[model samples]
Target: MEKRNIAISLPCTGEEEWQATREPLMSGWLTQGPKVAAFEKAFAERHQVPHALAVTSCTTGLHLALAGLGIGPGDEVIVPAFTWVATANVVLYCGATPVFIDVDPQTFNLDLEQVKAKVSDKTRAVIAVHLFGRCLDIDTLRAALPPSVAIVEDAACAAGASWKGRPAGSLGDVAAFSFHPRKSVTTGEGGMVTTANAELAEQMNQLRNHGASLSEEQRHHGPRPYLLPEFNLLGFNYRMTDLQGAVGLVQLAKLDGFIDEREQWAQYYCEQLSGIEWLRLPTVPEGGRHGWQAFVLYVDPAKAPMPRNEMMEILQAKGIATRPGTHAVHMLAYYRDRFDLKPDDFPAARDCNDHSMAIPLHNRMDAQDYAYVVEAIRQLG
Candidate 1:
């Protein structure tokens, strides 16, 4: 029989996405306009937040969130060492130092205990990442941090995920969410910042549109035709196009269905791979809901007869795609060289980076494909 190719991650798109695009194109007003505003409004309402500002990407959203908080030079922002570089890069973007903290081995999120030790008078905020679609225990983290320190969630991988019955984006003071192709829903390349704080939301709104109090489209139709909007702060052109917004609106509607399908696939993988001593399946904590972004398994090289790299190669030959769980931010070349850090500094993150591998868990997978993956792993044993 011919082998079937399995992708580690694939965006779910269909007629709805195409219809969304067509309508936006026919509207004529393409740049951040009614469509974008409606998307932001609907997103905010979905998350039960007061405001949402759509931007170019999650990275820019984080930057704007940090800027809105007035976190700049001489400040420190705690970030997980095991997440994407964007989490820490935003801190640097604001002229603040990113204080790296090791993640919990189980959840692959910032360790709450470690977060306490890292806090200081200079600590301005903590960028808590809901890694692999699992929400970090924000209540515990909030209890650990000083009252003055703001908590900004890097919920890039979490769309419909929740913690203790609360939505992911609403758990923190401000949160950034991604709409990248791999996410549960895609806007091609877009992001949104959610917050209940009115001032922060207003600031983020201005920051995303070149520091103008009113966006150009809003100003054009206003009575003050000759009045130029005031620029209160230095900002960036991080506006999301109307086309992306239209697609996102349609995608957001299907987010619950996508998450449900992904969870079902995850449960199937767990059932098939449970007895394999060499592999550690992903876990969801009590009272928490995971978005099931990527089904990651940790390969124990000692128990497994084959090495990690060898296993990856074998899987590739079998037409299965795999990827490393997020990078160890502290050990990345740029951060290591710039900060003079070593892998040993963050032991847990280092271990996670070395052993974790992500497998396919998209909505399209069926039982046969999953069984094939399990049998391949059994062969390795």
Candidate 2:
């Protein structure tokens, strides 16, 4: 097979998304109004949650979740050292200390033992990251946590993913999902926050819209023309626009289909690439319905034909794209200096940060693309 370029991810969007935007465009209301509300409602139903609030991005959604939970400067939030920087950044956004912990090497999820060990009187929350669309055992984690501590799910890569039989949004105290182009669902740049707690949901609603007592839709329909919402708390302009909402609705409908296709190809990788002893393929853990956001592999430098970075370079030369699944936040500049962190502080996270490689896997790719990637990796052996 001829070598060809394969992107790490591409949004599964087309004319349907384009046409969906028209309704929002034709209508005069363009802010976070009716369309956003409808998207939120549909998202809640899909995720089996009572409330789902739309936000500008998952980072903002996380901030809103933490803020809604009343975590502040004096508090500490436990986060897996291995994840997108936003997971830890959101804690800092709330002026809370982010305590980094190691991850389980195989699952790339947080180690519950480290989480339990890290908890203290100052610990207000633990951000359970459903990395690479594979959820960690939330039930076990929940049982381990104290009643006072909250669970804020960093489900950036988990949309259709589940723990046991429960969906991502329903497992934690509050969950944030991404709809970035890289995610299974795409609304260009948007996110949704889901929770069962009514008071927390209410607080997040206000927090996403400048702490407004009434939403724009409510204010417009109200009889009092001069009344403005009473701002009781500081908030951010993290509202998702009507255009994104309309597109989000279209993408949300196709989510299951997208994951199904990706999962099929992911399993193909596992079957075809198994003999490369240096390569560690990701798998759907028991009871886990992975959303298949990306098929990330752990390339062991010790036994591989070349180092992970060199392997990526060879692929890049052949018009294929690859990326490290994500970085160890503690190893990044800000967290490193601020906390005096060393690269080896969280060993598994450090190893994953250097070795986890995300190969092409998305709704846009076909069997040809999957086969091409497999051939290329096997050739490296």
Candidate 3:
């Protein structure tokens, strides 16, 4: 194995972040403080939503969202089988069953027909993930889903993505976003929950900070600054630190440029790989403005010269890194054994788990790196 020169994912942070983080560290007020409030305000304004509560991670944000929705035992939450397991795991945290459904074979998004088929009286919500930064069809979901069931957009990979000119965070009833290093904008490790409903937003706000009726900043800054806060309900300590908030401000400002650079690189990948008959490239649906978080491709094993895993191995040997797009949640041991699920139950999802490949697509890559990835894959023929 040679020394790898290209990375599959990288955070494109610069002096702005270093300079921003200095104040938070120096001030000695690192918990959710002024910086966190500023970040929340900026994020809410950017998404055109009334509320945005910063959290420790997207996983916690999803948990808080489901908890806020009052989804408990016996309720079912429909999840796409082809996403990161966290989307479904949160339902488990709420003591609810996660009903797995197949995604569209082409777009790799939630299949509305499958969703309609799965919804029942016990259905409480649906977790619509914007996988790889492409916005799922919210309009069709709005029209098809009954008012009794809620929609939670897992916009983990979608910061700049939009559908019909509306931002991803604002499209669904409530949304959760990630600012992990791999995301377009990063806070090292942080998440945000956005919603138009004041009641849900207030509940989640309390739920993230030990169920406090008043935050530390609120209590310390008000007229009765010495008073301790009240804990009204059960909550988790999922608050984002001021350090991350400071970095988030810098990253949020750079998000659009990051997306633009990623889109350009993605187009290059598409153009260079277009002639390869064995590759199935990603597609942007009619109204979807892709954020291009990651460039995922499907390798048809029957048509390709090698199998998907073999192709990944070959790429790895060439000093290029690649990964499966994501796992089929149902096929994982816990879900399979717990629910008595089989791999063939959701054919499209199983095929995706076996064949879908995520290659290098990030702001850190240059033309030379892109060329190497394309040439390496082309050689597989």
- Give Cα-based local distance difference scores for all models: 0.90, 0.91, 0.91
List, residue by residue over 1-381, the lDDT tens digit for candidate 1. Answer: 357788887888888888888876987878898889899999998888889999999999999999999999999999999999999999999999999999898889988888888898999999999998999999999999889999999999998899999888999999999999888888999999999999999988898888998888878889988878899889889999999999999999999999998898888889889999988999987998998888889888778788777888999999999888879999999999999999999999998999898888886777788888877778887
Better candidate number, 1 or 2, judged by TM-score: 2
- Residue-by-residue lDDT tens digits, candidate 2, 1-381: 887778888888899999988987898778898889999999999999999999999999999999999999999999999999999999998999999899998999999877778999999999999999999889889888898999999888999888788899899899999999999998989899999999999999999999988888888899997888999989889999999999998988988888888888888889999988999989888977997887899999889888999999988988789999999998999999999999989999999999999999998888888888888888787
Q: What would you estimate as the lDDT of candidate 1?
A: 0.90
Scored by lDDT, model 2 comes in at 0.91
Better by lDDT, candidate 3 or 1: 3
Residue 370, candidate 1: how far off, in angstroms?
A: 2.2
- Alpha-carbon error at 32 in model 2, in Å? 0.6
Estimate the TM-score of every prediction. Answer: 0.98, 0.99, 0.98
Q: Can you write out model 3's per-residue Cα lDDT over 6-123, one digit (the tens) per residue?
A: 7789999889899998998998989999999999999998888999999999999999999999999999999999999999999999999999899887878898887788999999
Task: List clashing residue pairs in candidate 3.
Answer: none
The list of candidate 2 runs beyond 4 A from truth reads: none
